[model samples]
Target: MRLALTFLRINVMNELQYRANFFLQVLESVVALATGLIVLSLIFAQTDALDGWTRPQLLAVLGVFTMVGGVIKFAIEPNMARIMSDIREGTFDYVLTKPVDSQLFVSVRQFRLWQLTDVIVGAAVVVWAVVTSDGSEQGSVTGGGVALGFFVSLFAGSLMIYCVWLILTTGAFWFVRMEMLEELFTGLYRAGQYPVGIYPGWLRAALTFLIPIGFAVTVPSEALTGRLTWSRLALAVGFVVLLMAVTRTVWSWGVRNYSGASA
Candidate 1:
């Protein structure tokens, strides 16, 4: 934790030197949030609900999506993504020489501090949605439940994201052109913004079993809205543990396969 804080502070000091970038980040976040909220609002305008979900309920889910998505774009996605290029070009050896775990080092080596703007904006949207749609109107969620669900979902979502990246980048073990796989992951991650129930049954099932996104966004928000089932929460936790194990196994196999351009 200390190391993360130290890295965060250093990043803050560095960013302060370039104030212009801060405003640019805020502007970008505003545009992104506006576009997301507008489209959802327009869709709800056509109908009272989408798949048993009202406007505020869906809006809450959207807020979680943005918060998680921003974190990925800002750091997790960008850092882990460079793995393939680094391996192909022989630049990853430097990371091997460092004292930290190679996986952790690679996963969070950089901070796109600007993306925190999206996190702030997402929080605002979620709070407003909750307040505006109190009681059964928003499905009878308590403050305690929402807090608990937020952390639970954050952990599950982050774990699934890490696993997906690990598996995709691990492809560099056998092939050089792995960006295609990463592109596919990006598209699916975007689609995760909507409730899984919003999609067809097959696609929803795929997201739950194949990709593990079911635990990431939907289940977390469901907890906040008093809509989550105990069975689903258990399943989410179990899925996160299982996927983390699988990702570790694959990562070890990939490292063993790596020759590092030196016989």
Candidate 2:
């Protein structure tokens, strides 16, 4: 943990040198937030509720989506890119020789400090949604339980996402040209911006179990809105453990394969 924080501090200092990136990041976040709000406005204009989610509830979901997407863009996406590039350029040898765990080294080696604005914006959106949703009979965000659930679910969801990325990037050990794998995850993640309940049963199941964006975005938002069920919470916890185990197994296999080839 100390080493990871050291790397993060170094990355932040380095990124500070490129001041123009700050403005560009802010612009990008504003545009993304605006686009989401416009879409929400259009959808709510047509109907007052979506899959039993009121406007404020959906906004909370969007907030979770934005925050999770920011985290991925900030950490996971950059590292995945680096993993692919290292493989392609034969620089992975240097990573393997490092004293640190190779996966940890690769994952935290890069940071985009500006992307944190999305997290701040997303948190603000969630707070606003919760405050404005006070009068609602259903989907009301209240009490310590809902807040605690939101944070817990958010952490578990993030681990699930990290595992997914680890599994995807682990494939690069064999398939060197798997740079497009992140794009595939991005495409799937877009589906989580809205309520998963509106999708077909099969699609919902796929989002819940197959891809896990539903658990990452929807389930956490549901927690905030006081709609999360114990069964769903159990499922989320189960998925986190399952995916973490699978990712570790796959990463070990990839490392062994890489070591053998290098020797």
TM-scores of the candidates are 0.88, 0.94
Tens-digit lDDT track for model 1 on 21-89? Answer: 989999998898888889998998899888887788788888887787777767676676678778888
Considering summed lDDT, which 10 consecutive residues are worst modelled in model 1?
Answer: 134-143
Which predicted model would earn the best TM-score? 2
Model 2 residue 190 distance off true place after TM-score fit, in angstroms: 1.1
lDDT of 1: 0.77
Whole-model lDDT per candidate: 0.77, 0.86
- What TM-score number comes out for model 2? 0.94
Root-mean-square deviation of every model: 2.8, 2.0
Candidate 2 overall lDDT versus native: 0.86
